[model samples]
Target: MKTGLREKLKWLRKPDSTPATADNTRATEPDRPGWFIPQKAESLLATPLRRQLMKIIWQRTSVSAALFAELYQTPVARFAVLAQQLPASEYHHHAYPGGLLDHTLEVMAFAAKLRQRHLLPAGAAPEDQAREAEAWTAGILYAALLHDAGKLAIDMEVTTGENQLWYPWQGAPAGPYRLKYRKGREYALHPVAGCLLATRILPDSALNWLAQYPELMASFLYCISGQYERAGVPGEVVQEADRASVAQYMGASAGSVLDNPQPSLAKQILTALRELMHTRYRLNNPQSGSDGWLTADALWLVSKATADNVRAWLLQQGVTSVPDSNIRLFDEMQSLGLIIPTTEGKAIWTCDIQATGGWSPGRPLTLLRVSPERIWPDADGRPPVFDGRVSPLSSVPEQPQACGDAPAMSPVDPGTGTGGDLLSELTLSLFSGTDDHTAPQASMTPPSGSEEKHIAGDGLLTVVPAETESQPPPVTEVNPPVPASITPPVAACSGQNFTDWLREGLLTRKILINDRLARVHMVEGMLFLVSPEIFKLYVQSTTGSTGDEWMLAQKAFQKLGLHHRGVNNINIHTCQIRGPRRNSRVKGYLLTSPEQIFGESIPEDNPYLSVLEEGSGTAT
Candidate 1:
């Protein structure tokens, strides 16, 4: 190991010298100025819920778990001290007091449970599994436990009793620490923070054991660094556990994993809506309320407008598991408190709104009415109501045809039914990113951590509920840039995202690029990506997005005028297929440059493919 890694290993072992019990370590606790999690690390872990988590951890990795205690359980205790009292998220499941501890225990237990089914270091011989199982299990548990630790300091502000600022990377807070989610903290990379945090909590001995398994250690690091795609089975285990935990907590599943393939569908609906509200839709606008309108008494939003926007946004962000129906979308929103129940307890309402200025005639529209205070700001200007008396146009639907569980295209409300069932899941503005205090605004550049799958189990409050992931907490400043250089921005939908995606995919093994005559290749240090398939992928990612549809993306790449043509001026190439039956030609393009997208070495050329470049006849 290099000197720097050696120094880091030495530092990770530093906590082991102290007693694992908080009481024993209390006197020696570093005198720092931030509020601690408000409970001793040992005590918190000793709780019934956490004890059960330890039980699972022990069963999964008894040898390593024993070592955990032998090391004074000091590192584990340090994490608990920093994580106590803080909620895993501002809202959604487990967003209340002590949510972090609950969530941590849940994820650890879930990861262990999921691990029981996998033969990890997958494809390894049975003997190798027996030898490495405990170590692998321990690494996963540790990874799951610390996956979101970055949220501690990177996403939120931890303040001292005297209100002094404290960062978790500096080490565990000295005493009871208060958490204030930083405003506009959407840009911080909590996963990167988790990697930094692991330095403080992972003991050197544990590191040594884990590092011995190169594949296991690499996956472990990939997971901690927020690149789940590379983490493989271990990452999948963590993800599955996260999803299951979120489903269990948010009442999506009553602990029945087998109930639905999409156990977290309800959570997904809410999350999609939340993301739309955060980055795309406008609420409480005065002149033009394209998405919704909020007034002092209530928040009135166009039903289809909100639904379409939420669905489109979620799709663009790569959440493909969302339900396809607007009715289903409304049902989940109504179930999750994104919309209030009607007098008869349905999600949709029909009413006529006349312009307050009397410049326009009365118009009928389907709308979702919610509590005004839920999204309105007391300090800012309010929306003006229409002049006409807003009355329910019709009675609620009676499970008719045409729309599935949705009211007919028109509105209907029967005064007969009572307020049926109020939503149990009321999301505070935590996951949505902005509340009333932040006025509706236009789109800004995507945040720095766009590549990361947010999932806040609660994404912008949109994506996964079973994961109970929270949005990255607010950051006080721009985080130091990563050592890896980012690809410069290119024209939207110009196959630019595909290039970057392919590069990362190659590095992370998300895309297959090393096989013979692979669909994608690097030649002359430039990309030679397959046609149509690459275009299809880009299309799928931006399902509901406008402007950059499939054909448009293909055209955009063509317009870039970077793809190569052969000496015969052929952009498409035909290669001989060495088969008994026949030969074929596959169409692809040679993108301009590799350094343009990856900004790093390709590491190695694919030994199987011929290198192709523009204005060159060489096939080597």
Candidate 2:
């Protein structure tokens, strides 16, 4: 083994270990952070050994449930049972004496918290707020308990002497070196292997169903396999639990597992996720003052896709059986609109199932072979047709017989869309006082087998009509920048936004997006959009002079943020006038529009743009 890994292993087994009892608190117990799910402490205590540990712990001192879970998992009985069967010392990490028991506790805690925050459900007292916590607790606990169950075949070692070599079994031999087990064989491959073992441990009824249905197992595997990744929620919980347990067993800090159990980690993850949610909110109704309907929709799609793909892959890989009740986790994400189908041409589906092999926590994966689908524009945008579709993409539909061929279509209520385009009217109703003129927005049609979907267009629904020449005599113009009267508020941007409008503008205008590049571009766009509100606020809050490259960026974002608070800040302007100190190597540009700038980019120009350059070399 490498010296670093060896040192790490040695560190994990250090002495001065704290007893695994719930009552003993770590002296450094601040607010235990990092995705904590509140579990039923009383319930956990009912499990035989855990129950005993709990009694032992409280007898000494009271501790938070989180702390109790951390300490309770330190007992030897849990992982030791599984480890006894594994002969290869190398696989020990997977079933290392107490690892499984420890991870299971942590996962349960985290899952419980998730359910509460997301309202995952707890039965009768339901609202969205209550449901998520239930789902999280159930899904995560199951995965945690069985995660490392397959590590029984691994070996263990306790070496001594200068040259560490020899075997534990009699025929295993002995030397000047006193080795407990052979080298080069460890718990490195336990997660994938454990998944296979899970099938056997589960009742045959459960096992047989999943065996026939790969998707069921895939969901479990996705959660377990991703335990090593740094960013995701599931992996973070598992890794932290594993670390906390090890830290108690050995006297050393198992920082690599959970690292610092700081509140900052929780805040950071929440902050990033919130930003993502905010950006989605603004994009859905740039000019519509709607709630986070669009953002909610997008998130739902992501969750669904993840769940579906995981289910599909697991079944394909032959991990078919799982608890029936637990199957609802996959279903809920779909119903809540957490996962979405791939946009047409957005991604290519690869037939290669081996791509996900050798899976581990924190490992990066490329979900190839996913079919792409085009983004559809909302009703308020363009294209009059909203109901059942029957036409080809390139062809425009004829006017509806009911509405007739009137170019002056009725104005839609400004902002009433919800998560599924549910409540757009409340936000965008301009003429509420006079109900007769307002027209209702059309509803979306379900997908038919073979429609050619299109990319969601930039939020420009239509060009406003110029005031007719024959209207009443013009009123005197106000010299001051502020408008004399505020127009009624329209459905416009909401939620704190972070999109980098400059990057998005560049990409959308300059890049020729095919299927493959679109999704990648969108993900990049999402990241940029959820980054910071500094850009939009900067532009709407100021004007030129100090304006230069940075100012132009700020100005562009004001539009993307959809600054429709009132009539005074109706539009956004962006221009690269001049930097105070200019270098020819760095050129600049500006943009101005009616909506807030959600995101932007400055990618290298394409060959087509290169051909449009005015000068051959210098300014000849």
Q: Model 2, range 78-174, lDDT digits (tens) per residue?
A: 3323322232212112222233443444334333332222322223355432323322433344465555554432334433233443221221112
lDDT of 1 by residue, 1-620 (tens): 32332343344443444333343224333355333445577667765445545655565554454454743255667788777667776534455556676677667766766677688778899978977777788778888878888888676777766667877665555555667666557644886678887767776667776888899999999999888878988887776566545544543432232111222444455555444444445543333334555554676667655555555544433344444455666676665566786777777776655445443223555678866544432324234543333455665543212233432221111111212121111111111222111111111112234221121111121222232222222212111111112211233355565555556555433344533324565545557666545554444433332222544566556655566555655554422222346533334566656666556545355443455333453454
Q: How many residue pairs clash (N, CA or C atoms closer than 3 angstroms) in each of the candidate models, in the order given?
A: 27, 105
Error of 2 at 125 (Å): 16
lDDT of 1 at 145: 79
Model 1 local distance difference test score: 0.54
TM-score to true structure, per model: 0.52, 0.24
lDDT agreement with native, every candidate = 0.54, 0.27
What range of 10 consecutive residues in model 1 has the weakest lDDT sum? 422-431
Runs off by more than 4 Å, candidate 2: 1-80, 83-100, 114-136, 155-182, 186-188, 199-217, 224-620
> How many backbone clashes can be found in candidate 1?
27
